[model samples]
Target chain A: EDKVVQSPLSLVVHEGDTVTLNCSYEVTNFRSLLWYKQEKKAPTFLFMLTSSGIEKKSGRLSSILDKKELSSILNITATQTGDSAIYLCAHQETSGSRLTFGEGTQLTVNP
Target chain B: AAGVIQSPRHLIKEKRETATLKCYPIPRHDTVYWYQQGPGQDPQFLISFYEKMQSDKGSIPDRFSAQQFSDYHSELNMSSLELGDSALYFCASSRSGNIQYFGAGTRLSVL
Candidate 1:
């Protein structure tokens, strides 16, 4: 069965701290991995990585994929109270567009 | 920029009832996807349609059915609602080989 696992299911840190979230997947035909930050409503697109070793960054958030290890990491620097939300990792297989999501890392940034 | 739109931000229904959730994709998007997120759970892919055709299916229950129309809009029709059916239903749209844009989900509560 294909599955995606995320570590440190929950994390807490004061403002300005940095955090790293990990996601590993086991699937038949790997295509791409995506990162999304979900607030109270919908999950917003962050990054999509199809190639390994190339880091994708936007603002204070960046992510990289390690295809050899079947895993990926999301790094958030200079965290703020506004960054408190669930960070989700999902993957799509080459066969279709269906996404398999990890449990997500709940991040709480205290001021 | 136009984004994916979903209807009935909130819905309450009794067990054994039925519900229909609508989704309007971003203008010109070619694919539509449906997901269900339980309390504190990652969003799970339910189904997807591309060009008005069923492209893929995930862990959707047999009681649930979905379709995309000629205009590229989609609808998820859920029947025989159970307490376990309560979840946040999200509709996402994307162009092939592009990142999906998620709509503000419909929160369904089955009492």
Candidate 2:
């Protein structure tokens, strides 16, 4: 059974702190891993990592995939109150685009 | 900068009632995927269409049906709804089958 697990289900941090969220998956024929940020109603795409040893970054957010370990980590630097949201990680198999998602990490950045 | 579009942001229905949800993919996107997210649960894959054809399916209930039209828009029809069917239904579009962009989800409440 393919499954994705995220640790530290909920976290609270003061502004300007750095936080790391972890996700590990076990799937057959894994193709890619994706990250999303869900706020009030919708989830917005964040990053998609298909290779190991390479980090994908957007401003203060970055993520890296460790294919050998079947895991990934998302790092948020200089967190702000506006960054508070649920972070989701998903795995997509090579056979199809169907996604298996992880229970998200709820990060509340306090000012 | 176009994004996937969903209609009827909120709907309230009673048990045994039927509801229809619509999704319009981003222009030129060839694949569309549907997901159901229960309260505090990870999004679950329901179904997907590629180029107006049923390409994949997931844990969707038998009471639910979906289709993609020539214009690449899709609809999910659910019948005999139960309390368990209440969830946030999200639509996502991807041009290359890997990275998916999601739309604002439709929230369904069953009483």
Candidate 3:
């Protein structure tokens, strides 16, 4: 079975702190890895990484994939209370469009 | 830009009843995917369609059936509903081989 594991299931950080969320996967025919932020209702798309080493970034949020280690990390700099939410990591295999997701990391950015 | 749309934001049903969830993909998107997320759990892939055809499936119960229409809309029909089936069902859409965008999701509660 394909599995995705995320570390530090929950975290509490104050404003201006930098946090890193980790995800490791064991999947067959891996194609891509995606990140999402879930607030209250649905998950919003964050980033999609296919190649290793190259980091994808958006403002204070960034992510990098390490295929050699079978892991990925999402970094958030200068965190704010608005960043408090569940961060999800998902894997997409080459054989299908379906996504396999990790249990997610619940991040609480304190003021 | 238009995003994926789902109907009946919330639903309540009794055991053994049936429910239908609908999804309208973003205009011009060619693929749609379905996922189920239980309380405090990550989203699990259920099924997917491409160009109005079933393209992939994963972990979907036998009592659940889904199909994409000619207009690119999809519907998930679940029968013999149980309390365990109560969860947030999300519909996602994307251009083939692109990042998937998710809908607001339909929360189903079975009593």
Query: Could you say which candidate leads in DockQ?
Result: 2
DockQ, candidate 2, vs. native dimer: 0.74
DockQ value for model 3: 0.72
Write the number of the candidate with greater DockQ, choosing between 1 and 2: 2
Considering DockQ, where higher is better, how would the candidates rank from best to worst?
2, 1, 3
A1-111 in candidate 2: lDDT tens per residue? 899999889999999999999999988777889999999977899998986568999999999999889999999999999999999999988634888899999999999
lDDT of 1 at B97: 43
lDDT of 3: 0.94
- Interface C-alpha root-mean-square deviation, candidates in order: 1.7, 1.6, 1.7
Candidate 3's residue-wise lDDT over B1-111, tens digit each? Answer: 888999889999999999999999999999999999999999999999999999998899999999999999999999999999999999999886588899999999999
Q: Which residue pairs in candidate 1 collide?
A: none
Over 4 Å off in model 2, which ranges? Answer: none
Per-residue alpha-carbon lDDT of candidate 3 for residues A13-86, written as tens digits (9 for 90 to 100) = 99999999999999877889999999998899999988657899999999999989999999999999999999
lDDT of each: 0.93, 0.93, 0.94
lDDT for residue B30 in candidate 3, whole number 0-100: 90
Clashes of each: 0, 0, 0
Scored by lDDT, the top model is 3
